[model samples]
Target: MTGNLTRAEQKQQTRNNIMAAALKKMSEDKGFSSLGLREVTKEAGIAPASFYRHFSNMEELGLALVSEAEDALQAILLDAKALEEKGEDIVASSVQVCMQHFRDNGPLFRVLAREATGNSPLIRRRIQRCLMNLNHQLAEIIELEMRRRHRKITNPLYIAEAISTLVFNLGIASADLPYAKQKEAEKRLAHHIRIIYWGAEAMANSQHLSRNIMLS
Candidate 1:
């Protein structure tokens, strides 16, 4: 099947295979920090030495997985944000899409959520970096929306960090619930996000009013 692909494509395929194998191992109650190279290589159907070609070591592989999760999450959040321009409820839209993504890519997301506080400091730091990246991206999006509405917030990054933390925490929680309960989780998440936005807007208005009063 890989015969028709170019050399670069084949290497990418092997790299994907290695990552998949690692995910599979992690899904079975094993943390990435505890996984051995030989076990992962065997699962990937590649020789142990071949692993070095893709990743320097297990830590590097774990970082790759984190990178993939970061990209997937950014895409999901951006897609939900885009819906807000179309009159869709961004909170509900984001929850529904994010939950669906968790369902579709459970292992990938589960690893990310678990490793965020796992025993490995390297993995934990990488996860923190991923969340920080998401926070900044989300802040930019929120800033644009605020500008569009002629609104001002003291710091969009704070709001972004709050929203990102809440959504990710709730999203991970929802992943463990059954389908019916997941729906309830979605409602809770959407409600929480709305409240955050509402408070932010109220503060911005109050600030605006205070400035006008002083000017008057």
Candidate 2:
């Protein structure tokens, strides 16, 4: 019997526990390549055979961990979207919200970060695909901000890619930092974001101005 859940809920709970165990195991300075199914099942307090009930293999479990990390922080985007609608500095707001999530969900961030740089080639590529999906989602928001402000970006995707690079890279790097350095990293990231914001503006405005100058 698993907790207070019915049979079906217990089954789902077991699956969640397995994933959590994997995350806990991988939380240290390690990656998925070092995780073992037996170790994860033991930590989850389930039979190793039961792991197959939820995941076909270790790679499947690893993929689920990546997806779980994404699901965990979807709220940060919701808050950032709301702030953008309010015409706030979404870049700065998102940095704070994200680092807060990093603090709250350090293990999940560690899972994503280490897996991204893990020794498993397949896992590395899959994680890159996941990050690219997040990049596109961010691009959509950038387009929304542009339209809402009546601003033009000749290539919103380009700007979004740049911002995504900063956020994703700095996120992992910052997470791996000592707590003392996190605040400074946040400030540094904020400066990087402001530069991105201004560069995106210039991408459209300055280019348009140059066009006008050449026309005259």
Candidate 3:
């Protein structure tokens, strides 16, 4: 006789498959609100009642999809961090990675951004938490770079928040724009990053000059 899997394990596997299928369908349509529970269950090859075993409703499923999108975006950022060791320009590498990620995962990002604005408290909170986590990660990197240059950062948190919001909004906005507008948006994003980097450098230099004068 063949050994059978446990009920919990099978349920989890089914849930995972449902989420995967739902994301695939959302990506194809680029509209989460239009996707119903029956559609997801049908796509997953499951009955309508089985969908409830995995998620309470489509809103809950949408929140889970936002987490998945955040994980995917974080992987790209981690890859950019690795590229920092390869003698590549950090800001340029970062922007390239971000743009590529938006291009690759536009559907997921668009769904999360659009649905989070609707009448779902759970989805809104999940999206906000993911953004906060991302901002913190970016802040850590900015702090590390400042320490590497022996620079004093007077307002690192503010700078990091500004950069994170700017980058995140750029990715969201680009996903909805036309091809020509997308190119212009990317250039504008790059310019914004460059301005932030230069301002940080100038602030560091001014601080150094002030310390030297005080010592003298």
C-alpha RMSD of candidate 3: 4.6
- Write one digit per residue (lDDT tens) for candidate 3, span 96-142: 67777887787677766676675677778888888778777777777
Which 10 residues in a row give candidate 1 its minimum summed lDDT? 84-93
lDDT of each: 0.85, 0.80, 0.77
User: Model 1 compared with the native: what TM-score?
Assistant: 0.84
Predicted structure 3, TM vs. truth: 0.72
Worst ten-residue run, lDDT, model 3? 1-10
Residue 46: error of model 3 in Å? 3.6
Clashes of 3: 0
Deviation (Å) of 31 in candidate 2: 2.1
Candidate RMSDs in Å, in order, are 2.6, 2.6, 4.6
**Top-scoring candidate (lDDT):** 1
Question: Where does candidate 2 stray beyond 4 Å?
Answer: 1-3, 117-122, 176-180
